[model samples]
Target chain A: MIHDFLIYFLLIVLIYTIIVMSFNLAVGFTGLVNLGHMVFFGIGAYASALLALSGAPWYLAVPSSALIAALSGAIIAALTVRLKGDYFQIVTLGLVFIAVTLSRNWISLTRGALGLPGVPPIFKDSLHYMIFVMAVFALSVIFFYWLTNSGTGKIFQAIRDDETASSVLGKNTYFYKILSITISTFFAGLAGSLFVHYIKFVDPTIFDLEFFVLILSMLIAGGLASIQGSIAGVFTLGIFVELIRFIDRVPLLSTVLAQHPELIGASRTMVYSVIVIYLLIFRPRGIFGRVEV
Target chain B: MPSILPQLIINGLIAGSIYALAAAGFALVYYVLKFQYFSHGAIMSIAAYSFFAFLNLMGMNYLFSGALTVIISILATLLTNFLIYNPLRKRRATSNIKLIVSVVLLIFATALLQAIFGSSTKSITLGQNKVFDFGTFTITSIQLSIIIIAIIIFLALWFILKKTRLGKAMRALADNKEVAQVVGISPEKIYTYTFIIAGMVAAVGGILLGLEQNLYPRMGIPIIVKGFVSSVVGGLGSVPGSIIGGLFIGLAENIGVLYFPTGYKDIISFVIMLLFLLLRPQGILGVKARDS
Candidate 1:
């Protein structure tokens, strides 16, 4: 029983690791503060699910959904390149609101919050699925690690440090910013696809603020601009958040919570909010942050 | 369908006044501080809840409840600045860090409100409202008061900004912090004054919002988003711009429901904001573009 729990826990952590790594790429590495990264994840989840449910193969749906998300990212990046940092952040945040509204309102495609269930799993067996996810996680880590160390990665950092300086060096900073976001969003979309298949459900709640807050907390805790930090952040916060479930096991508190069950969810949110506030104020750079905000 | 046009316009104006009230205060803090003070929404929530408590829970009269609510909100705002923002400023935190902290405080405030209030919707039952009809359009007393109060506040704000010593200091600081400091303007003092005024203004907006809509812990999120859209549409840091932007968005959103589903109303403002951002990033007031 413990072994099964551990495997599932690791699988969930790996999925989040991919998402946070992609988030770090855009925000920490590229310095875009892309608040709408969740839109890519949601889009990818929906795209992958609809395709797979309509009889498409796993290999085809996953990458195709990722590419679709990347294409949307490229378009958004292009349209928003002229904006400065804060403006860009707000516009992207607006995209999240738009995505949620559409997912809820466009009942035909998204089913309007009822969610699409019965997604075909790539591996029915839990152990095999864990191995497959583990392989994907390893490949993602290696790819991101290599990409961030390459010459192009150096340019990404340079652009992040100072866009004007990068442009003065005859580099098209806009194109590079778009490229960074595109690559980051592609991975985010892939993680989303994997998540939906594993959970066997896709819903508008997938675009909830809680998920964004969770991903953001992980990114901040691990510190920015490092792949290892991304992984560490995800594992640390993922375990901490998951451990909230054990609160029910407490002797006296469980009885009190049993009388008012709503407090459970509210308490979790409060913990997240308080932790984020404390971290941002007291430790802005986080545990392994390479670049200072 | 006997042209619900006038009614929509009236509804739009009423909504615009509330939004303008919220956006104006938000724009003031953003102008002086040079960062998005997102906890403005939290202030609104706090004031609304306090007003609800004073009027409903404690059985106080309207005027007394409002006065007490404003005082409490100002205290809350100052406490937030003292506890969170002041420390960050002393440490020389960047704008991004400040913005993140503000966003987190908003979430924290929301969670706190939910924990206390039990996530149930509350209304500030002000008894029965008196309705005044003028041919095609009908206005409730509360709605009329909201518009009148908004106009009064804007005028008062204009007076303070244009005719007061503190306002001059604030403008000077916003124009150039170092130069203002050299001239002995005291940016920190100006920041305090800015928060005070922002708190008072947004608190009234909150009271009005509670009277108009059903109060929920998450009510602040949508209100803040609309105010934010107003801020951007009117130009990020411009005072008058936010007012115009608020009205414009209010009108557009209300009129948009004529053709599109009501669920898509927020989308209209968002799209307009995007268009304004991409094409006229300077906004309608043509404020000098900051930072490329």
Candidate 2:
């Protein structure tokens, strides 16, 4: 039982690491603060959930969900690319609200907050299937990591550093910005589909502001631009949150803190906030953040 | 048809007035600080909850409770500036860090409010819900009060901005922080005063909002979105533009709901904001340089 729990926890962390790494692509590489990153995640989950419920196979549903999320991300970027700096932030923030509303209210398609349940696990009958899933996720992460370290990665970094300078150098900066956002959204969506299948339930709450903040905190805390840093951050934070459950089990601590079992939950978030603040104050570059663009 | 239209206009003006009051406070901080005041919503929420707590628990009258809340909010605003903004300003924090800090403070303030208020809606009955028939239309007493208060606030702010020495210093600072400091305008003093005034205005707006809609912990979220939209539509950093933009948004949201579901009201404002950012990113009245 303990082994099963640890495996589940580790798998969840691995999935989120991919999501946060994708987020770092848009935020860290493009200098675009896509506050609505969860919108794509939700899109992926919803698409996969709907497909599986309608008797679609897992292989087809996953890629289709990713494509849909990528399309959505590209559309959002295209529509609001003219906005600069803070205005762009506000626009993305607004987009998140719109996305959440659609997810919650579009009852005909999304079931409107009743949520999608009974999603099929990717490999339900065997432990070997879990290993395969982990292998696939790891391979995708490795591929992206290598891609980001290549010449294209430098182009992305240049676009982030100075869009005008890059454009002046004939880089077609807008196309690259759109490209990076779409690619990021695609992987985020892929992760979302995997998550829904694993949990076998999906809800609008999964894509709310709190989750967005969690992903952001992970990305920032882990190290902004690096794939390895994001993975480390997600695992560290995810395991830390899971470990808080043990706080209530500790005999002495429980007796001293009897009046508030929920203190563990609250303090868990508080610790995350403090970590973010401390990181921002002491090392804005983040732990393992790349020094040179 | 004409008579009912006039009444709708009147109602829209009243709602717009409240928004203008809120947006002006928001605009002041944005103008001087060069970033959106994320915690302004929290200040509004805190003031509403604090006022409700005092009125219900301490047996204070409505007006007295409001005044006390205003005072407390100002103090809290000052403290927030000291704790959050002042240290960053001293360090010459990056714009990105400032933005992130604002969001962090917003989340922290929201959590703190939830911890205290327990996620429940709180309302204060001021006994001012009576409706007055004005010819072909009717208006509530509370609505009328909101309008009168909004106008009074706007006019007062106009006078201060146009005539007061401190207000001139504020405008100077907003225009060019370095230049203003070179000419001896203290950025710290101006920032403190800006936050205090913004907090007081937001508190009053919050009280008025509580009167209109029951006060819930998450009420500030939508208001902040709408307030930001209004500020952007009117042109960021422009005081009068904020008022006009806020009124236009109130009218559009209120009247636009007649054609579509009220849930889409926020979407309408958001779409307009997107269009503005795309076509006229500087906003209708904002200066070109302010786009940065």
Highest-scoring model, DockQ: 1
lDDT of 1 by residue, B158-182 (tens): 8999899998998999999999999
- Which pairs of residues collide in model 1? none
Q: Residues A1-293, candidate 1, lDDT per residue (tens digit)? A: 99999988998999999999999999898888898999999999999999999999999999999999999999999999668647888899889889988988899998888988988999889889889999999999999999999988888899888888999999999899999999999998999999988998998888876678778878988998988999999998888888877766678978987888888787777777777777777887778998865
For candidate 2, give the lDDT.
0.78
Q: Model 1 misses residue A50 by how many Å?
A: 1.6
TM-score for candidate 2, please give it.
0.92
Q: What are the TM-scores, per candidate, against the unseen true structure?
A: 0.96, 0.92
Encode model 2's per-residue lDDT on A158-273: one tens digit a residue.
88888889999999877888888899999989888888888889887886665777787778777767888888888877887687657667788687547755455544555555
Chain B TM for prediction 1: 0.98
Fraction of the reference Cα-Cα interface contacts (below 8 Å) that each candidate reproduces: 0.55, 0.16
Under CAPRI classification, how is model 1 graded? medium
- For B1-292, candidate 2 gives per-residue lDDT tens digits of 3546767777778778777766787787888788777677778778878888888868898879999999988998898788767777776666666666666666666666665666667787776488898787798988889888888888888887889998899999988888999999998888888888888888888787777778876677667767778888888777778888889888877777667776566677777877887888777786453444
